[model samples]
Target: MSPRQRDRVRSLVADSEAPIDAQTVAAELSVHVTTARFHLNNLVEEGSAIAINLPPIGVGRPRVGYRLVVAPPVDDLMLMLVARLGETPEQREELAAEVGRAWAAKHLPSVAIDAELVPDPVVLAETILTRLGFRITDVVSAFGQHEITLCGCPLEKIEHELPEVARGVVRGLLETALTAGSPALAAQYAVAVRPAPGGKCELRLNLAQVADSTAR
Candidate 1:
């Protein structure tokens, strides 16, 4: 089977609100039932998806269903905020950053700021991104800045459709994480999301020159 087809099947499982059976997968992809089952089983074996017993629909035996092992939580509030907040794209993105900040504060681990302890922003970034189901590809340090490349965003669909808002979300998450660790260092750095060579996105942290700025 083609890798793209398998990825599509995985995406279908990730996007669905309810568990999907082989029959449903076959119908959706217009593939044979055996082919669908094969892909679903492969996903289960690979630990990306799981098989579960679905509720019986007036039948003798319950059907088995496939679902993502770690399905990303749907953010209906983000959509509502997007629709109600702003008239223009820029306004929406600006407001969305606030929403993202609040989200990161709630979801990310609480940090105890210590004056003596210097926090590594990249570590905090990895913690938050991994918790949010993003796959980080590479982290490069150059020119007094660090660039983190990531793919397989949990909110891939939303990121694709609302790029401005997506950028806001990413920006807020990074900024808030940095601030929690060290307000001084946070002020010295700026976060920007840029497109990478492949489908990956880069989180570039631009450091501004300020002597002893990180020292507390």
Candidate 2:
């Protein structure tokens, strides 16, 4: 279907530990079962997630569920920091950059991975986040804009590390997705990262003028 829909499915599948049936996904997203199924099929086809068929219970037909198959572990620090970024848009980039620097300064001290081996900044950030267990929940596109939301990752541990490079990576990913024309509109873009009550982090994009102003 739409890019936004695919993003949403990615988010949902990433968040789930086990296979999730269409009914559950529909309920969480407030969409019709058929709509959920359509998106799930798309995700499966894209190789972003996997679909599992359940054994029949007794009465009717068996149900199917989808789960994220290619995601990495969830990082507690990244989750918390991303969530906090949502509260203030005026300084999101600055804040994200600062967070990234802080992370490098602190955690990088003991990390032994070669710099060259690290994926490109954006992919590395996404990989670290997925490893930290963040899930994609929604990809919204309206009025010529694109935005994505992620949930199910703890944000408390790494709030201090979010700054500079980390923020840049997040912003870059949003730009990349938008440049790819994930959204049908041609407008300014904004990315919001926040955490929910259940240790779930929400990353959203706003295509409204507010987004345009912030981008400038």
Candidate 3:
């Protein structure tokens, strides 16, 4: 595969939540297994993905799978959205808010704002979502409120069983997220942990209207 094709394959793998094999890649990309293997080996050699060995229950040898270890670029998505909105400040703001709302819908459990504490909740919301492994797909702002759309899971594991190291990682991430355009905006930031359906965990932040937003 060419470099561009390899990059596209990598993006697909990152977007997928589970490990995949060469055959699966071939089918997904409409390429032959040989071609898929070529790119997979190249990615492994470059350390972009790791080869995982899974043993079958019947005492057979392990099968190989590939897992992505890197993330796709946010700038690419942002640039596309910018182009779509045209070259106007109002359009840009609208896009930014749209992005925010979309992000909150997919990634956050729920969001509400302590308007008395922060001037711009959308920016704060985006920061938190980014920290949580959700990429900002789009953004817009209206009447002082910002909206964002997001995808991906920075914290995919169950929260109750989260290790200390994981909690530390999230805490550090939250610290970064809490920092917005100004100290006042930062002070208003807070994330609430709640139980998600199907026994999963979700994050609720102190930003408004996130639940109503949907991911793109």
* Candidate 1 lDDT, 64-114, residue by residue in tens: 899888645556655665666678768867876887788788888765789
Residue-wise C-alpha lDDT for candidate 3, range 1-216, written one tens digit per residue: 778888878876677787777777889889898888788877899988998876654787766778877666775664454445536544543443444444444444444545456445565556565645656655655654443443324544423433222223343343344443344554444432223234233433223333322220
lDDT of 1: 0.75
C-alpha lDDT of all candidate models, in order: 0.75, 0.54, 0.53
Question: What is the descending TM-score order?
Answer: 1, 2, 3
lDDT of 1 at 180: 82
Against the true structure, whose lDDT is highest?
1
Global CA lDDT computed for model 2: 0.54
Once superposed on the true structure, which residue ranges of model 2 sit more than 4 Å away at CA?
A: 71-216
Compute each candidate's TM-score over C-alphas: 0.56, 0.31, 0.31
- Identify the runs in model 1 with alpha carbons over 4 angstroms from their true place: 1-84, 200-216
TM-score of 3: 0.31
| lDDT of residue 181 for candidate 2 | 37
The better-scoring model by lDDT among 1 and 3 is 1
